[model samples]
Target: MTDTPGVSDPVAGKTTGASSAGVQSSGRTAARGMAWTALSLVVSKLLSFGSQVALGYLLAVDTYAIFALLTTAMIFVNGFQNPGVSKMLIQQHDRLDEILPDYSAFALWLGSIGLVLFLVVGIGFEMTYDVRPLFWVIALAGLSIPLKAATTVYMAVMSVNYDFRAISMAEMKRSLFYYVVLVGAAALGAAGYTMALALAAATLFHVALLKRATPGLRLSWKLTPRRFWQMTVEMRWVLLSSFLFALGMNGDYLLLGEMLSAEELGYYFFGFTLVANLTVMISMGINQALLPLFSKLKHDLAQLRRQYLRISGAVTLMISILCIGLVGIGPMLVHLVWGGKWDPAIVVVVSIAAVLPVRLTANLAGVVFESQGAWGWRLMTLIWDAGFILICAFVGATLDGFNGATIAVALQRLVSGLLTFPLAANMIGIAPRRTVGFFARCFTVYGAVVVAMLLADPWRGVSVHDSTLILRPMLETAAALAVFLAYNLAFNRELMVAMLGILRRKKTP
Candidate 1:
């Protein structure tokens, strides 16, 4: 199964020794994993997007605002829960079965701690911020702690095992279930929709269904205290790094809510959610297989460096193309998918999209970090994350409201992306200069594409009215992609070939 694409043998694609055959059969495994993961994510996103569109149609903006706030708070609380420990376990890949029971206890305990902490935070936030009555509805969603813990365990196990097919299927099922619940609740109106979202652990339930499908793995309730302490000590640095990363990522929303109206915050919130979730989905697809693959190759400096550039370049191209397309047609998408009411969010979406290539690169940096298994390397990102939040807070307070905050976020992410190269190089034992040179080539390609987009239409009208006006965006996007693809093909030949080869393999397989 591992020797070649779709092979029946589990260790068929081994490039290493025969006894350790499965270890070396990662390329085909990665390809198959990426394909299934991509399919699952694309399907799930489409379904979720459809639900959001329906929700937009049926619910009032205020109701959506409440729902968005709940999710944001959930994201914040989840930071304390420290889901990164799961990734750490998968990456470490040593004594996992013995370690699993202990780590599971830690996850449960963390969930308990997170629940208490968040409830306090939630109550204080309401009192201090003087939030609405429905804010309590948001806090009630914390009851899903065990479900989240279970999910962390299951997802980590599957990822470590390179079972992308199982992961993808489970994800697709969860997305469908959530969408069904969402649509059913929305039909009953605002309160029902809110309840459905808060209770949207439908995915967690589906994990049971998945367990039945793959029967060997069993869930254990035994709490191993000593192991739990050991795991926690090991994961403390990971926890800090993850917390900082989350802060940098979500700090803008926190600020927007504090400084701007819920309505304005809602608009920016929607764009930020859409962009971040999409990037996460992409990252998940690649990272699911990449972490274990990178971990296995950690000692092979040459292979590690080669894979790093290939993965990073492919991700950069995908995100850059997505950004170009969205920027060109974002207003129309907002109008068509979300109705005219969300037109305010279009510019925010475009601006966020423009800077997402950097965020994607940062994800590559994360893969490198996870592979290195060195906690201190992530300390630099901790500083970066803190600095970014401070920057956002200062700029958002002093500048033009919501839009200013969004711009600040874009600038911050660009810096994060640039900072990733040296950090990634330090961990992977690559020359910092070589990594920088690779990015410089990518930057040159991206810059040329942007220049062409500007030259073709310096002041492309992005504003929308009654008309759909989809053609202008389509033309602009086509023009941008043409220039970008042609430039990569002509100038960045290796990058172009790698992407084409991945696509071709997927199509043939």
Candidate 2:
């Protein structure tokens, strides 16, 4: 279930006795979980990406702009609904069942609050910007909040069981369902109505699927003032951390929503959403199983440190390759997939892709720290990250407009991600220097691949709307990836071997 390609039962064999058994079980769980999650997420992302491509390609730029802005607001609102109740429950899962009823109440209340909050924000936005038809868009998106809450309780159960297969499959189905509806809606040209219908359908599916998946789990409508208050107090740090993290992540979109023209923002959003969602689809898809796995190893500091290096290192390496690969092919991808109309997003996507390796590293380490209950630690890092990005985005946007803001935000992410290492070292109980090999290996591969891409004639010109030109970049990316794979084979053999083993794993009787 963990995305770490560097560990399984064999790696866990470095330890002995009860700790060894625990690590072994976690390894096995992680291996099986990662297998299903990886395979499933590919399908899920393809489906989700298809829908998005449809939206951007078929719809007008303004239509896409309205869609992106509405989704940005909706995502921002959704973030505040849960501080980390489900995450904390995964850590202290033994008591999860007993508190399930109370947790349901808390989640429901949060969703309800978020719904009202989003509505108010929507009204304010329209009043301020005079953006039309978007208020209804906001309303439809906001209404999905409670329906999503309906799935939270059962999802917690799945997390406790390390059932990433169920979680991943559900996400795949949701994406499939959403894609079907969204693409169909885009075809009919009722952009706002299309979004509203798709959201309603996808969210309702969340409730129905999880209910069947975790049959014994049930939601409670009854709320208790005392218990809710107690839970809120206990989760205060987590709540603030969650809210800050959300604001930090979404702050750029919120800012851009105001700063850029709808068309410009739409182009930026297309690029951002592509990589941003792709990043999460790949990163968090695996992180689904990492938290509980990390929690299990929290007490085994020696094993924890080892697993942290192996897992986080491998993840960073993959991100490096992805960044390099995307940089080489980004322009052609825009042409091949979404059309020449989205050419403005090419630089946006490439710039964002360039800095994403560190972001992924921070995310993988993030679960490690969260598993250790370092809420305060996480909160501080997020504050700096959020603030840095906001300042950078504002200045860049003001000075040069859309492209400047995109690059600035990317730079901010890289800086914040790198600086979190010292704090991450303390939280993960490792020496900060231990992660040096990670940075060296990833950077080496990135440099080598980029050099290879450049040597492969990355600057070659292609005719507009000519589909044949894409093959050149695709070949260039493939060659670049070959360099990455060869570099790993030469120096990262053990990690690669372990990753292959994990991918080949199957469920045992």
Candidate 3:
């Protein structure tokens, strides 16, 4: 049997026998870390969704939009402070204990700087735009920056040490705090409640937990100018790549906010958040499991490729099916679940769902590059964004004014999927044509399933008021999905086995 990525290669084959040992050890460690992160993510997403649901019911969509804008602006400003040094520390080969303190100090100083920046920017934006309430949100949300920076380092330590239990507990605490606070504060209404809950969860709670978690954690300004310079130099490229990727991923919301009204943006944002959450769950789960192990098994490219496809294909398949089903029944489900007020979101919901597989694929590509220490590929994210713009423009020209924009957003994902071919090829060292073909196959499968569902619909005779009208779409969609999965598994037996293995392991001890 051949060695697998994150399973059989380490030290680039220089110390073959010993490297195998490290790979074995690291795999277990990374798996443990992933387990904890998964737990936290699950809990956090659940609580967050529930909180949002309650808030939405109580608050108007406009208030939600305000909350969204504040959160987005805060994220944009704080982006400058986080430069990925935490990953550098975690991924390095040695001396984590020594490395941890430097990172801690750097985080503190960066947080301080970030806090000041937030204040200045918050005041300026709020005053100029008459968004004074945002000033308070920014001021309060500012605390998450340093706390995030610090928690980031602490999480890095956990990953490096493979102590996922601690990491999971910390996240669980954070999520629980957010839900409890949000629920309690919702009594007062939306804006204040959201702000208060965010502060408690992200800022104060994080800091307290981080401090308790790291008994000896300390920060100092003792680092030499030379070291700081080196850190900056190394981090700049990674930061650039990360920023581009984040911008590309997030820019659509900004665009929507500018091009459309608040109500439209609100619908788009909610749908986008829902789909993005699903993508995050799958992509992050695999990545968190794979990256640390990849550090140990860097040489086993073949194994890496196999494992990559196995995990990625499974995720892609699941997301694809869920997305297609949503497109068919999403509007109905949204109406049924959220009530009449959220009816506007149904159109955008299906539109956003259409691009989920593409988004997930691109996210996976980023994870691959991140694991390989390939910062250059980050530029591809911008290229993908360019495609988003192009497709958005195309859809706008073809469809009804605002509806066109929303549809264009989904079309952008398809364009992004096509655009990422070369990037994926470069990252994986596969032929560009072949790599494109692989993704094309995925798209074809998903599209075929969707097409079949549409074909089966009895459009000629179907009545809107008939109970069977609603059930018909669901039934046809389910059948199409069954066919899609059967075909997918038949063509990719290894992938199916791997997915089965993953599921079995989850069920096992």
lDDT leader: 2
Top candidate on TM-score is: 2
Q: Roughly what TM-score does model 3 have, to 2 decimal places?
A: 0.83
* Candidate 1 deviant stretches above 4 angstroms: 1-24, 79-82, 191-199, 224-227, 451-470, 500-509
TM-score of each: 0.87, 0.91, 0.83
Once model 3 is optimally superposed onto the true structure by TM-score, how far is the C-alpha of residue 505 displaced, in angstroms?
3.4
Segments in model 3 whose C-alpha atoms lie over 4 Å from true places: 1-41, 127-132, 190-196, 207-230, 281-287, 383-401, 452-467, 504-509
lDDT of each: 0.67, 0.72, 0.62
TM-score of 2: 0.91
Positional deviation of residue 56's Cα in model 3 after best superposition, in angstroms: 2.1
Cα RMSDs, all models: 5.4, 3.9, 4.9
TM-score: which is higher, 1 or 2?
Answer: 2
Which residue pairs show collisions in model 1? 1-9, 1-10, 2-13, 3-12, 3-13
lDDT per residue as tens, model 3, 98-171: 77766667666666677888788677657644333767776777767776677667666656656556766876
For candidate 2, what is the lDDT? 0.72
Model 2 / residue 273 / CA error / Å: 2.1
